[model samples]
Target: MEVYYSKSAKDALREMTCKLIEVMRAESDNIPFNLALSGGNTARQLFALWQEEYRLLIDWNRIRFYWVDERCVSPEHEDSNFKQAYENLFGPLGIPQTRIYRIRGEEDPSKEANRYSELIDQQLPKKNDLPHFDAIILGIGTDGHTASIFSSCHFLLNDIQIYAVSKHPDTGQLRITLTGPVILNDTPLLIPVIGEDKRKILERLLEARTATEDFPAACIVYRAASAFVFTDITI
Candidate 1:
């Protein structure tokens, strides 16, 4: 695990975008670069920065976009993660609609999970019947959750399914999230965690101990792919 402590959230976002551009350029000859995005305050800020600074750094038409997690709400809803990204980044950047793959979270949660799994299996690089992502961006919750996998969510630690349904610990709202197996598959994983509140959990993730469902961020270290941690918190 590598940590980069930037001066502020905007600085961290800029560096992360440069790293992502490099990753995309390296894999340009492949079918398409797969990038999974997480939704939260941090992601919103990052997308805003991408819109202002790095929009032209990569060919948006050649990139495939996926979300790491989504609330079970209609895409038109204000709280929809897809809506946030669309309005803030994708729409402004003129990214083709075909390149964006979103979970139909407003539908039945289980059905949505199955549909997303099938969609990914069709789109992702398949080798020996397993799908692999080119890169994935994740954010850490103050509670140590990543994606919708909360502290008590046990299924996140398993490889049985590509997507799973989980509930927010406080709101009880249902959400769809990619499982750890799918996230850690042969790909580069980037986690950008900022703020002093996340410092303790980030430290635990670097300790390299056995991962428990209680600390979802800890699972990223076990991923076979390269992992990078970009943060603004000081150690």
Candidate 2:
């Protein structure tokens, strides 16, 4: 685990985007730059920066976009992560629809997860016969969840299924999330955590205590993947 502290959230976004551009350029021939996006205020900020500053640097045609998790709603719905990315970055930057691999959340949640897993199995590179993403961008929730894997959702912590259907223990809304095994398979995972509220949970994750169902973020360490944590919060 490596931590990069930025002066502000905006700076962190730019720095991460620059790093991504370099990584993509270096690794383009091996496979298309498969990016798994997370949804939240920090992610929105990063998307905006990509649209404004880093859009041209990315080989949009060769990049395959996927989401780390999604709300079980129509893609056109206001709360939909696909909609948010489309309106904010994909549409504005003219990224081809064919290059975006979105989870069909409006479909049966379980079926949708399976469908995405199959798509990934087909698209991503194989390591030890398992699909491994080139890069996965994630965000840390205040309660220590990543993607839609909430603190109360224990089933998501393991690699049993490629995807899982979960509910926000507090909100009761359905969500489809990539399992930890799917995330950690063979990729470089970047987690951009901002704000003071996330500090304690981030600390706990770094300390590597016993896995708690409530703090699903702790499971990130199990993967043999490299984790880059970009944060603006001071410890």
* lDDT (CA) per prediction: 0.82, 0.81
Question: Tens-digit lDDT track for model 2 on 1-235?
Answer: 7778898888877777766777687784656778899887887788888888876677777788999999999999987899889988999999888899898989999888889888888887787677777788988887778889887786787757777899998889999898888787767888888777887877878776445555677677445367778887776
Clashing pairs in 2: 151-214
* Model 1, span 127-203: residue lDDT tens: 54667888889888887788888877856767577898999989999999998887777677788987788878877
Pairs of residues clashing in candidate 1: none
Once fitted onto the true fold, the runs of candidate 1 whose alpha carbons sit more than 4 angstroms away are 207-210
**Candidate 1: 10-residue stretch with minimal lDDT:** 218-227
lDDT of 2: 0.81
Maximum-lDDT candidate: 1
Q: How many backbone clashes does candidate 1 have?
A: 0
Supply every candidate's count of residue pairs whose N, Cα or C atoms clash at under 3 angstroms. Answer: 0, 1
